[model samples]
Target: MNSNYHISSFCKIKNNEVSLNGSVIYNNENNNFSAFIKAAYKSLETNYAKFFKMDALSKLAFLAADVLLKNEHLNPEEENNIAIVFSNKASSIDTDRKHQQSIQNKEDYYPSPAVFVYTLPNICIGEISIKYKLFSENSFFIFDAFNAQHLLDNTNSLLSTDKTKKVLCGWVELDGDDYEAFLYLVTNKGSIIHNKQNIVKLYNT
Candidate 1:
């Protein structure tokens, strides 16, 4: 059993609040999702130019992953040792709605290539990978709900096979104005045990 793996850090973003390892790092109750997320981005002090162009789902995922990896020092030799495993219930429906609206009216149909690009949820993974230079195996699963067992299974398989040294796995769901992001980094050293039960409990917390 790959029971030695642990959760080094976790991040939760919901209700216009962002918390890292159980402590609130950013929160804004007065603004909507767009303004709130942008505020959070500014708080991180990251200057990724492309961030502004990403759809809401990508922006949310990017911000959540950024909170975890911001302070991480990547070794050139081990830069490819990190993997990302993310799941979401909505599955890019937020962006799909935008793309659908752009062409739904036949009389004035105008499909946008920019909006079409983000119709798939996995693009957020690409955004994170590009920013952090993580080239390990990455996957995005869509389930009716958050499936921690599946995440555990895949993460354990990757680690046990020595495919990567760490796994960034979590549930990032966004449906219109309702959204939640729970991301955690799993590695050999941490304060929390990496298991199905603990994964579920941490997500709830």
Candidate 2:
């Protein structure tokens, strides 16, 4: 896919949350995974019920996507040309840990199907699509680190084929004692350059 769409803007939430051309959404001192999850959820919406219902990975994706979309003022339905391409390192290991723990505990040796369903990395894409009603091509890739060249090449191929007019691509990784999500909204209409250098510069800035 040779996509011409440029990333108009991006947002990231990590140990110390950061945003491109926007304010930091949240900065929590608790340093607990649950605390980070709660702060991230609050960054997305005021409804706590909805927040608690989402799995850990889903919550992370939602918060990152929500912040990016809000900053870009993007409506997936209106555009009707948006897609999501997410990559991660841990690949839902956190969920897997919990599931394994459930079965390991003889007293509570029952694995909840709900929790097991989120073991796949793509679940985050599903959650984001459902939340934004984006019925476009979505994919989840597992990598060792932030592979900017892979992202650029893959996105370019996807866009070149006219399969998707816009793309939301990023690295959303989570694991024990670590969590980070960086997302950018790329569109065919913008001045932003689409290359490894620009991608690195964007993230660095």
Candidate 3:
């Protein structure tokens, strides 16, 4: 049993507020998602230019993952075993809406391949894997609501298998200007237990 799994760090970003490990890092009354994400990226001092082309949902996931990995010592061997497990209610619907609008009119029909690529929610996982050099197992799930049980079960299952040493799991939901992300890194080291109840408390708290 992977009973030793623990949550080392957590990051929650949404409602114009960003928190790391239960402490608020950035907060504002601003309601703009893209602008705030851009600000967060700049604040992290990351030089990834591809961030500018990502859709809003991917941007949110990318920033949240970046915040979790910031200034942390990552073992090169362990990096490949770091898996991602993400969930959302919208599941790329925000970008789907934009992609639909791109061809709504024949007079101005111009669908973008760049924008089209983000229609699948799992693409963000790929983006994160590429950015952080993670090549381990990963999956993205979409549910009607936040299901901490499913997330925890799958996370533990991955860890139980010897294929992965750590799992980054959470909800990264978005629609228009409304968005929320609560991401946590679970491993064998940390005080917090990686259970369903704890995940719910961390997300709601």
What's the distance in Å from true for residue 143, model 2?
1.1
Clashes of each: 0, 10, 0
Clashes of 3: 0
Error of 1 at 191 (Å): 1.3
**TM-score for each predicted model, relative to the true structure:** 0.94, 0.87, 0.93
Identify the superior model by lDDT, candidate 1 or candidate 2. 1
Error of 1 at 58 (Å): 0.6
Clash pairs detected, candidate 2: 1-156, 1-157, 1-158, 1-160, 2-156, 2-157, 2-160, 3-160, 5-187, 5-188
Best prediction by lDDT: 1
lDDT of each: 0.90, 0.76, 0.86
RMSD to native, candidate 1: 1.7
lDDT of model 2, residue 114: 80
As for TM-score, the candidate ahead, 1 or 3, is 1
Give each prediction's root-mean-square deviation over alpha carbons: 1.7, 2.6, 1.9
* Higher-lDDT candidate of 1 and 3: 1
| Alpha-carbon lDDT of model 2 | 0.76
Tell me the deviation in Å of residue 103 in model 3: 1.0
Q: How close is candidate 3 to the true structure, as a TM-score?
A: 0.93
